[model samples]
Target: MNNGWFYTAEFRDGRFTQIQWQRSGQPPQTTTLTFSSTNGQGQPIYTGAFQAATAVTLVDLSGGNVQPGSQVSVEVEEWGWARGNCRR
Candidate 1:
């Protein structure tokens, strides 16, 4: 995540589901997810609700091609009070 959230790259059924996010003490919640593209299997453009603190998954694909400092971006509405963008 752009907020520096470290996430796993796998999900149940063995698919690379999402770039998941979750903060300590906060239970995972669901939100709508949008994917830019599908994998080589041709899953197709996907949009659906998922569970996590703030999931930014690619739905049913791998992020193996995504490198650090890549152009991929994450948008946050507003960092909570005392949580500056560069701070955490």
Candidate 2:
């Protein structure tokens, strides 16, 4: 079943980045974060920030899944920043 767990990061500078649905109870995985802008038509314009940016780390915590009573938490951290198209 899809746990529908996702990680999202919003920069104070107005950037929204989201990671795909990740399964719980699994080892941590490295995912790339990205930013984009909107065109005049109001469509998302994506750009690659793999070079200038650092890596994003995601951690899964055991919760509600182990014992009868428990909780799960997701952690996220930003490695670095990338310069290019700003978020709109």
Candidate 3:
């Protein structure tokens, strides 16, 4: 089977957030995933909730403000399989 995933990030109100991951066609039966964020120091910052859906939204709560040239990145991964991995 061909597994696929998508992710996106956005900044609003000086906070970093994710829009959601939309599946290509249909949703998965057993969808298990996790979300996390960190700072430039590679420290664990924020962790998001998991759900069963084609997409998910993430939020960064590092208590830092996001500027226009702020260097922020996000990562998404799929559990039990090594297919869905995103960074931005």
Candidate 4:
């Protein structure tokens, strides 16, 4: 099952947030994800909400502003997992 188990969200300012997940056949969930690190531009990244769904994963971004023409980098983390059997 491919499940799209891993996700990486890139910021416009060249910073990225990544998440790893697993499912145990339970239900959908929504949680707040905070970035404890800064981007390549030396600015603190913002916090966002992560929602695990069947059709597609959703990320609601809040805070942090980026400037133009900057390079981006990604930081991956094995945060946690989601449990669900949602058909949709």
| Candidate achieving the largest TM-score | 3
For model 4, give the 10-residue run with minimal summed lDDT.
54-63
- Sort every candidate by TM-score, greatest first: 3, 1, 2, 4
Clashes of 1: 1
Q: Please, what is the TM-score per model?
A: 0.30, 0.29, 0.39, 0.24
Clashes of each: 1, 3, 1, 3
lDDT of 3: 0.39
lDDT, each prediction? 0.37, 0.32, 0.39, 0.37
Among the numbered candidates, top lDDT falls to 3
TM-score of 3: 0.39
| Candidate 3, pairs of clashing residues | 21-55
Candidate 4 lDDT over 1-88, as tens digits, reads 2344433333433333433333566444433345555546455543444454333222222224333333223222343333222111
Tell me each candidate's RMSD, in Å, in order: 8.7, 14.9, 7.3, 11.0
Query: What value does the lDDT take at residue 68 in candidate 4?
Result: 39
TM-score of 4: 0.24
